[model samples]
Every structure is written in structure tokens, then in C-alpha cells.
Target chain A: MDNSDFKGKNILIVGLGLMGCSFADAFRDLYPQKIYGFDINKEITNYAQQKGLIDEGLTKINSAILGECDFVMICLYLDDAVQFICKNMDGFKKGCIITDIVGVKRKIVSSVQEVLRDDIDYIPGHPMAGKERQGFGYADKKIFKGKNYILTPTKFNKSDNVDYLEKIIKAIGFENVVYTDPEKHDEKIAFTSQLCHVIASSMVDINVDDDISNYEGGSFQDMTRIAMINSKMWSELFIANKDKLVNVLDNFLTSIESFKMLIEKEDPKLIDKLDIIKKSRESL
Target chain B: MDNSDFKGKNILIVGLGLMGCSFADAFRDLYPQKIYGFDINKEITNYAQQKGLIDEGLTKINSAILGECDFVMICLYLDDAVQFICKNMDGFKKGCIITDIVGVKRKIVSSVQEVLRDDIDYIPGHPMAGKERQGFGYADKKIFKGKNYILTPTKFNKSDNVDYLEKIIKAIGFENVVYTDPEKHDEKIAFTSQLCHVIASSMVDINVDDDISNYEGGSFQDMTRIAMINSKMWSELFIANKDKLVNVLDNFLTSIESFKMLIEKEDPKLIDKLDIIKKSRESL
Candidate 1:
């Protein structure tokens, strides 16, 4: 958790996209030794290398490339994470603590753990912060600053792995670090994260037929800014966390039904309900 | 429209809240001849007096207060605009043109027309502008600048009065002013305005809970900025436009169902559906 703890540690960041590269940027500033990176996309690897976000970049995660790091952080897509760990688990350092920057936990933990070597611990960690813009060009060193980072450690995971992951996240400038059971983590995120993108994408989809959309003001644009998100990535997240996401969707739909009843009855109570929500948001 | 056209012409602005006061400020600056204002809240009238937003400020509208204005704009709640006009009709000049800022159209047009004398013309308009912040203190002269101002006129309303109101709106710096039939106006707004607030309020209400709201970020705040809206005022609008609002809510709930199904399938093919929606929005 100190400067000495980070000194001379070799860390491998897999998938040099915005999240992966941002991790390298934050770590490279704090660590004294190697920050290695790998991405299937050569353009992204070259971009991260040209930007000096990583000390070494490889187009593929070969055994030689994966073997050099004391720690490995999987930053690939959910499917890619599984494939990479399965193919390269033997190459990873014997006692290395592996973590991930994936948004969801329940699926990521099970998928990676199934493929990893018994000697390595696959700890699931998510830094709940990002911009609409993606890729290394848009990466920011200050992203995790003053943000909440959640770590989900299963019963099979080593306690030391959780502590080490927390220390890394803390060193990257996150102000709050907490642990939760994997189910609770996914359920809370289904409400807080996944449902948000769904609603945003839905709003934009509804307004597509409106001619006045060309003249949309800040309110409409603000409501749908994330509509441009990488659908491939989010669709994967949505499916991976389907059960919890569906529960959150049910709660959201229930609220909408209550709203419809208020409108149908011409009720004044809707205002007070809205006021309650507004007051609660202010407290947040 | 012109300074000469407005010279010595009296204009009455009912309500004198943010929307009304901003109208008065712009009209007073552009017209400068006679801008009379009325509000149930006397403190608002006194505050507008201190800021010189009106030529006359009165707590109530009577024959004396309404008779002096050549034009009357009802900026009161949708439920109150009709009653406001009915109670104060005797005060209006016999040949004056009346307009309103209420969101719904059919009831407003019918109620106002039923209560008005044959010599007066009732033209309803809704300026597609304003902020979440309400009241005179938040009023600004530039609120309507570059915004779309919708004028909803019934078949019985005079074309000349519509032209006059359009000119006044254009003179006040509104770039685009469109006129539409009353029923169509309400239906379009059901989708555009009322439904937007309902969705925003409901989304915030569902997501914000006791346990994890403190971890909210920009997406949640952006999605629910209008949740901080004046609930009493918005409730009245929703109820008065109940039929249209309910229809819009039904459609929105349908779209939400589509979303739920997509997430449930978690089939990679569903990503194509999201891409289509995303590209459709991008084209807009």
C-alpha cells in the first residue's frame, strides 16, 4: 500500500483499451519497474505504446509475454478473459494474484476461475467510473480519483489476493474501497449500472422517429449521451448479468406502473412521490 | 411584431412565475409600451416590481386589471388557466386576443372558448423551453432565445390573432415558431414532454434506495436532473393531460418490455437490435 510496495513490481495489463490503458497510466506513474500490456488489436497496442501508457506492448498474450509479470490484470472482454486465462494459465507466475477490470462480478469470477491455474487467485474488481468516450486517447489518470471501487472475492479466493487488489486500487487514487458478496454486487450493479444504460438507450430509441430530434436541447442530449455506447460490450454485460438485471428491470417497470396509475387517476400524489425521490437524490 | 405595432398596446401576463416573468422581461424590453402582470402570490409580484419586469403588478385580475391589456397570456397551471380565464373574462377588453402557456390543448381551448365573449379570440401556445428551476428569481430574459415555441390553435380561433402571437414570439428572439392543431399538439407533447418527466422521475425513484445511493455518478444525475422539478406544478400538468400522458406511458412501458426481452435472451443477436437503435439515434 506504500511507494515501497509498488517499487520494482512487474504488472501485466491485458487488453490495452481505455480501461486497460488507464490502469497502466495510473500504475506507471506510481510504480518503479515494468508495466507490460497486451491487446489482440495491434492499433490499440501501438496507440498505447506511442502514448507511453505502457512500458512494453505485445499484439498477443504469448507465454513469454505473460510470464514476465509478477501480477496480471485481465482487461479483456468477458469471453476473451476466459479464453486468455485458459490458454495462458500455465505461463502466469506461480504465486501471482490476478485481478480484472470487468464491470460485472458473478460471471467474471466464475469464468476466469474455471480457467486459471490453481496456484493463481482470480480476484474480481470493478472501478465504477468511466467516460462516454473510449480507447486510450480518452484515458484519464484522474478517473478513479475519489471514486468507489468494489472487490468481490469468492470463498475459493485467497484472502491475501483481496488485500493485494485493494492495495493496488487504493494506490491508483480510489478514495473508497469495499467488499461485497458476488450476488449482492451484481444485484446492486444491475440497478445502478446496467439498468442505467438500458434506460438511456431506450430513451434515444424512442425519440428516433421524432423530426424535432435534430434540434434536441441539452436535456434530451443529456438523457441519451450514452446511447452511443459499444452495444457489443454492453449486450454481453446485460446477458452475463441477466437474472439480477431482470429483477432491477422489474422494479423499474413497477415504478412506471405506479406513475401510470397516478396519471390515470389525475392524482396529486405523484408530485409528492417525485419530491421524495428528488430529496433522496440530493442527499446522495 | 414591430416597435410601432407594440406602441401603446397593453399586454397582460398571468402567473408571473419564471416562464411568465421571462416573457414579461423580453416583452418589456422589446415592446416597452405596456406590460401588465398578475399573480396569486403577491410576493412574486412585489419581487417583479423590484426588478421592473412589469408595467403593473396586481394580486388579482379584475375588470380594471384585465381591461387595460390588449393581449392576455395565461401562464397559470393547465387546471387553473380555464378557471382563471372564466373568473376574469369580464375584465378582458372585448376585442383582445388571449393565449396561454399550458401544455394540454383540447380542454384549454374548449374551456376558454366556452367562457369568453364572441369578440375575444382564445389561442393556446406552449413554448418548448424553461429550466427545472422555477419562479421569478430563476427567470431570465434569454430563456426562450433560440428555442422552439409551439402555438396550438383551435379551428374557431382567428388566424389574425395567431399571426399576432407568432410575431410577438419571433420578436422576443424565438427562432422557430410552429403552429399545430390542438389534439395533435397534446399527443405530440404526450410523447415529448409529459412522458419525459414521467420516465425521469420514475427512473430516479426506482434506482435511489437507502443502501447505495451515495455511490451515484454523473449518469444517474444526468438521467434524473428533471426529477428535481416542481412536483406540484408537474403533477397538475400530468393530470390535466391525463389521456395523452397515459397513452405515452403505455407506449414507454411497451418499449421497456422490449428491453426486458432483449436482456433476457442475452443472445448475441440482440446486440444487432441495440446497434440498429444506436445507429437510428446517430442518424438523428
Candidate 2:
């Protein structure tokens, strides 16, 4: 499918938070079509409609209105997304392509596939773009520019639907569209995203009492910039991807322990290790 | 002990590297006088002189020429700084105010005091500013603007000398001049600066093979920006402040382990810990 095919097709976004509103804005900019949205918070849905982010905003899940959407994008927490889909599976239109923007993939993909109709195309996605802040007030259409968007499709997904979704993702301004399986997606994301948040949060958690403003340089600020995270959302993500995240966390702890031992022993090889790390970072 | 008193006074800087040339450039901009420098690398010394960062550059240390300087700033690796001061102790003019720009404080302060004359005021200092790149070629006078300059003075120093050092630090465009004891300075810096570098290096060290450039977001880039560090310099610093740094590192590991347990058990209290971390980061 192309832009002309999506011109008159109705699209539904099942959350009006930052990511959801951002997607709505980007899609509206590309296709110039009506974009409908649903959010549990009436204020957010109303605000998004008022801001012209969505053509129609529903505070409650209306099955009849939802049944008409050609595409449905779920932008809720992992468990909440699974429950929302299971509760409203019959509401979606027949042959409507379903997708999501959740951080984790394995659990969400498995649960979503178990309950979704066989006729529906449920392709899980993750957009590698976010800020330390949250809310629709901070949403921007340019968030997808030059960012990676990953699509994890199982054997159950239709190839035509996957191609249609990829075209829409590219049209929405994502620079790279990576294709992978759910297991590999979750494993890679555990190291690249979730582990970074855990490190930043833990670094900030230990220094609550110290007045670091006087001594903090760019390095400290950069390392902890993501420490101001959305607690509830991240807690859900951490629990959802626990096994992979725990493995990465163990590797990080081992690296840190090695560093500690080198310092304790005043080992001369510490310089060699640091050189290797510097070379590694330079490659990135 | 003020700006006027510093006019026409000779200043000698040891180690014509990034931090050394930055100090020279900032000081020359504030008070244009004879700024002499010494470096083991003749190319760096010559480049600094040609760029007007220093008035005179010496590839080899000359005791006769160095003895006439009114002020001296040693900006070398921690061990090198200590050795340079010890070897050139007799070369400084009588009652000349001496200082250093090394990162760690306790050992530098102790060693400088043990070898210096009673009349020379050897106050240890740390400027909370740097870049990932090294060498005098990347040095800038504006690096110190709106940054913190800390002075760790002991009872062995004169009060008038401390006031003089503070005046020079302010004149260099530093936004804040913090006065702290050596022990407290090391403790705070272990949490704020050194530990941050350790974490960044370790983070990059583990993911050497991953092609992160295609998928990295702002948080990953921010956290690993300082991973491109000077190995020899940082290794000495990490060892010099090992005890305090080890304490902070242990606390950080404990926090990470607590987060792991929360995820492993799917504990609801993870939200509380994340909230506390968010609040702490906001204060920073």
C-alpha cells in the first residue's frame, strides 16, 4: 500500500500519550486523512483533539467505531496493551492491520497473537526514539526522523501486510526499517535500551543525598540524563523483559567488578583494558 | 592578591596538553603577560607557543628559567604531576603560589605539601571541565565558562594565597568557585566524576561487537560519550582515589542489584525506587 491507498482509510491510535500522539501527527502529515484516537484519560484525548492531532478522539473504547479503522496502533504498557487487545479483539475491523509501539516484543507478541483473530495481521514494532520527558505536551512529529524502527513478524503474519506496514513506516520518516524475529528483537533491546535505563536509574538512586550540583561536569550529567524516567512505564517494561535484562545486567556487573579489582590491585593492565574500551567506543 | 597584583607576573605551566593549554589560554585572555610552558612533547609545546596559548615554550625543563616564575600550574597525569613537582621543587621562585589541575585531590595535595618549601603555597585545584578529545589542539578558553572550579586547600597553605588563587579562578570565567577540603572533595568527586567515567567505559567495553550506530538513541550516546577517555591518565586517577571510588562503585552496584531483584521478583516497590530516582535527578 502507498500514500494514496491510505488517503481515505480510517486509522485508530489506542493511546494519546507522547508516542501515540506523535504517530497520529506524523501519519496525518503524510496522508492528510482523518486520524481517530482513544485514551483512557479524557483530558488527554480531548487535548489531542483540540491540538488537531486527531480528527476524532474517544475517551472510552467504542467497539462499533473501532470496528471501522483500517489500521490500529496500540501505544500502552505491555500488560495493559495485551489486556486491551484481548478485551477488544472483536471490535477491530476484519483484515485490519494491527501493530504496537511497545519496548518489549516476546511477551507482547505472544500474548497478542494468542488472542487476535486469524484474519487479523498483528505485527509487533518498536520505534527507537524517546526522551526523558513524557506526555502529549512533549510529542513531536520529528521524533521519527533519522531513527530506527524495528518490525518483528512471526510466521503467522501475511507478507503483503508486512510490506504495507513497512511502506507506512518509511513514509512516516523513519530512516531505517530493520526486520527481525521477536526473540532477537527482545534480546537486542534488552542491552540497547532497558539496560541503559536501569544503569541511569540506579546511578541516580544511590546519590540522592549528595549535593552534586557543585561538582557535576558534562560526564555525570550525560550519564544520568535519562535518570528522570517514567517510573510506572519503566517498571512494567523491566518486569516484562526480566530474563534478557537480567543477563545483560549480570554482564555489566561482571565488567564493573573487574574494574574494581583492577583498581584495588593497582594492576598495570588497567590501562590496556581502558584502551580497549576507548577503541570500542571509537568504532561506534 | 587580586587581578592588579597578577599583572606583569610571570606564570609557568607544566604539561602543554589539553587542560594545561586551556588554563594558559584562559589566563592569557584575562591577564596578558609572560606565560611560559614546558612539555615532554616538543610539537605540542611549539604548537602552543605558535598559537599564542603561551608566551614561551620549552621542550625540556629548565630549572634556571622556571625559578623566576611567580605562579605555576601542573596539569599532568596524577603520578607525573607528583614526580614533576618533586623533581622541580627547587626551580620555583621563593613564595610563589603553586597549584595543579589534576582530577584527584588527596594524594596530590599530600605529596605537593611534603616536598614544597614552607613559603610556597601549594593549593590543589580541580577544574570540572573536559572533552572526550585530548591534546592542546582541541583546547578552548570557553571550556571553563559556566563550569565549576574547586580549590582544595589545607592548613599548610597561606590565606592570602588562597584568596589569590580564587581571584584567578574567577577571572578565568568559571561560574562557581567551590572551596572544599581534600577528603570531602575526593569523596564527592568519586560519586560525581570518576565513577561516571568508569561506568561509561565499562558500558562500551561490553558491547564492542554490537553495531550500535544504526540503532543508538540519545540516551545511549549520552551515557557513553566519555567512554573515549585517555587510558593512562584515567588509570592513574582511578588508582589514586581507589578507596573513595571503590566505596561509590560498591553503592552503585548495590543499587543495580536491588533493581535486578525487583525485576526478578516483579516487585511493586520498583515503582517507588524509580520515583525516588526521578525526584533526585530533577533536583540535579
Candidate 3:
């Protein structure tokens, strides 16, 4: 089974949400042996199955279904994902490759590293792609197109398993696969993902008038587009990476304060500061 | 000249940069008598003329050019727009309706109101549309489509002239025309346009890595897209609207700080706060 193509693999999708169904639908096209989708709610898994996203749907932990899967994709939220995996640790096939689509890395990797069966390899990953919408009905395979997939591979993760996963990731339309450690992934993501959500969410929170979007050109709309967030999911992400997020937030506050001071004092250096920021952004 | 159609009107497009060229291009299709474009740089005016964005380009303010214009659209930066309008107040034709596309309204309307000729009516307006790219060459007439055009009409502005301006504004593809006083316009705009720019610019300024964009998903890109700032122009705008911008910035800082503290303390209320923010943004 070393470096096996997805065509010969039996896969399990642990949550029938947007990310789960998307991966299930993509894998269906690649002719996987069978897909067993698990969701605590039977309705979601049934809907996914009816949509041809998975070959079968399971409401309970069927040891046979879990034992047959060569690849298991856990698409649950942070704490729930850890709980699901740790509880079902003994059900997975020997040397089964288990990966997750959790947002944060440090907490997920550390928690999973403690209870995993040594025979099975666990790879922690984040697919940096999603719409503002959620749920199985909103799932689209194209969401993965032209997106980055970050892998924080534990030392126990087999190189062959990582390569096999990368093959499946690329086949599903991911444009880039970035390899890094759990700590580095969380730090960069804290800056790129969590910090942006914080700023966008705060921008929305400050609107004094409900109709203020009427005055917006394009800037306000673009900045706050992501503010149509799933609140529970995001708060969990924020608290999970609070240390890194707070650090980045402080840096952002400091940076904006300088602009405020420059404006407050009517300083001539404001132009230079704005010019430097513009040049830096243009490079990006 | 009472509520005249664009066909019989001669329009002047001042400061032939992106906004000026776009307006001129839109006016050409409406079959205005002639468009006299004014710019400080002779080469830019020549480029605009060669591109057919204007009928003729004037480097200096010609009394004949100013005198014949039934409508003068000042597309200059705030300070430059003020200087040009006040300096040439005497040259405008009687009952000529003048308007501006400056970001801030109070300053432009008040300055022009003090020295404006009684014979001619100045209707101050702000077109809530633009691209991050600058210059006439990048100007597109479609930028006005489905956008808001804000008007801050003064007491001296005649009813017929406001109607005349509204017709032209609608003809140029503006979807909505929002009417408010100068103070209200400044305040709302400070929250919508100026505050977004400040946040976007600061987001860029806080980047710890030049290669940070590589790690970004769509959120970071959307938030910082406007950070490609025109340093000198933006600095001028910030200083001009310092009081209003600072007030809103403080509110925004407070809002984000609440988020930071909520995350720092690992409070359960963070989810509720985020949920409220998400609902508020959805109402937009």
C-alpha cells in the first residue's frame, strides 16, 4: 500500500460539512474503492450520499467501515476533531493515513500526537480555502481550486504517506502544497488568517449605521466580506491560537496607532509612512 | 440652460487623472457639446486627448474654456480642487453648475461656498467608485456602474441645478445617489472609505515578511488590496478629515481590543460577540 493512488484506496470522510463533502465529491471522480462518510447527524450524511459525494454514509462508529479505510479525512472542528480521533483510535486500519482539515496546527497536532496508535500515521493539514457559506448543501468541489494546502507533518508521519496525500491533494485542484512545522504554520496562519478575521470582524463591529455600506465604494465591501463568518467556528480558532493572534493583533494596533498619531499631529512624515506601506503592498 | 439635456451642455473635466478621464469618456457618449479637460501636466492632457477621453485638453485654465462650460467637474485632490475652484471663481459662466469628486465634502463645499459666485451654482458631490490603480490610462467608464454617488448640497445650490446634476450622474451609470449634508457626508465617509483605507494600510504596514502574501488566503488579499496607497493624496485626505477619522479609528481600536481581550481571557462571550458582528455585517 506504499504510495498507493487514491483509485485503490478506501477513504472515510468524518464530517459531512462543506470541507468533508467537497473532498468526498472530488474523491468520487477519482474512482476510490469506497467512501464511508460518518456524521453524528444522519441527515447530513444521507444528503451527502444522495448528492453522490460518498458511496455510503454511517451514523455510528462501524469498526468494519473504519477498518477498511486506507485514508481517513477528519473534517470536524478543533476540539470535536481531537475528540473524534482520540475516541476512535483503535478502530482505524493498521498503517492507515489519517489527516485533518483543522484550521490551527499546534493544538490539533499536539492533542492527536498523544493518543494515536503507532501503526497509523496522522498528518495535520489546513486547506486555506472556504466560502463564507457553510454546510453540506453549500459544498462545492471547486472550492479547492487555486488554494494553498499547508501540511504540518509530525515526525511520526511517513514520507511515503505524505507524498501519497500530496498526490491526492493536487488531483483535487489544490494549487500549492506548503510543508512546514506545526509551530511555524500556526504563527504564519495567525498573522495571515486569524489577524485578517480579527480586523474584518472589528470593522463590521464599528459600523454605527446599518446602512453605512451605501457609502462604500469597493474598499469597505472588500474588507468586510469575510465578516459574514460562522462565529462559533472562528471563536474556537481564535482562542486556540490566542497567544499568536494576540501578538499579531498588538503589532497591528501599534502599526495603526502610528498612522493615527501622524494624522492627529498633522505630521509631514505621514506621507512617507503611507508611501512605504504602499511600496511594500505593491511588492506583495 | 434650465434642466438642460447633456446634448446641449459643454462640460469641463478638471484634473485629467483617472476620475477626470473616466468622466470625460462617459460624457462623450452622451453627446455633450464639447469637453475641455484641464490638467497640470501637458503630457497627461495630450495623452487624454489622444485617447479620445476628452475633446480638447487645456494645461492652463482658459477663461474661454471656463466661461463656456455649463458643467465643470473638478476631479482634483481636495486641496488642489479647492485652489482651482476659488482661484477661477470669477471666470465661470453665469448659472454654470460646478461639482467636485473629492473624497471629503465639508472642506470643499465650505471653501467653495465662501468665495463661489452667486451667478453660478456649485453642487458638491462624491462618486463612491474608484480602482486602486491611478492615472488616466487605466481609467474605465464602467467604474461608475452600480456605484453610489454622494451629494452634499449647500443652501446656495439651486433646485434645478441639483436635478440637472442628478440626471447626469444617473446617465453616467451611478446606481444610487445619496443626498446628505457636508457634515454627515464627512462623518459617514470617515467610517466607510477613509477608515477602511487606514485599516488596509496598517494591515500592510504590520507585515513581518516580504513573502507574507505567499501564505495568504483570500482574506488577507481582500483586506490589503486597498493598501496600495497613493501616499501623498491619502496623507492629504487623512489630515483633512483627521477629527472624524480619528473618532472612528478609536471606535474600531476599541472594538478590536474587545476581541483581543475576549480571546486573551478565553471568555465564552467571544462567540456571542463574533456572532453579533457577523449578523451586523450580514445586514449590510
lDDT of 3 at A224: 84
Higher-TM-score candidate among 1 and 2?
A: 2
- Candidate 1 regions exceeding 4 Å error are A4-7, A25-28, A94-97, A113-122, A133-147, A153-178, A206-208, A214-218, A267-272, B3-9, B94-97, B115-121, B154-175
Clashing pairs in 2: none
- Chain A, candidate 1, TM-score of 0.91
Kindly list the per-residue Cα lDDT of model 3 for residues B91-147, writing each as its tens digit: 999988889998888888888888988899899999998888888888889999999
lDDT of 2 at A35: 85
Give interface RMSD, per candidate: 2.5, 1.2, 1.0
Top TM-score prediction, candidate number:
3
Q: What TM-score would every model get versus the actual structure?
A: 0.87, 0.95, 0.98
| Best-performing candidate as measured by lDDT | 3
Give each prediction's DockQ, rounded to 2 decimals: 0.43, 0.75, 0.82
Q: Which ranges of candidate 2 are over 4 A from the true structure? A: A208-210, B4-6
Candidate 1 CAPRI level: acceptable
The C-alpha lDDT values of all candidates are: 0.78, 0.86, 0.88
Candidate 2 yields a Cα-based lDDT of 0.86
CAPRI classification of candidate 2: medium
Q: Report the TM-score of chain B alone for all candidates.
A: 0.92, 0.96, 0.97
If ranked by TM-score, best first, what sequence of candidates would result?
3, 2, 1
- Point out the higher-scoring one by TM-score: 2 or 3: 3
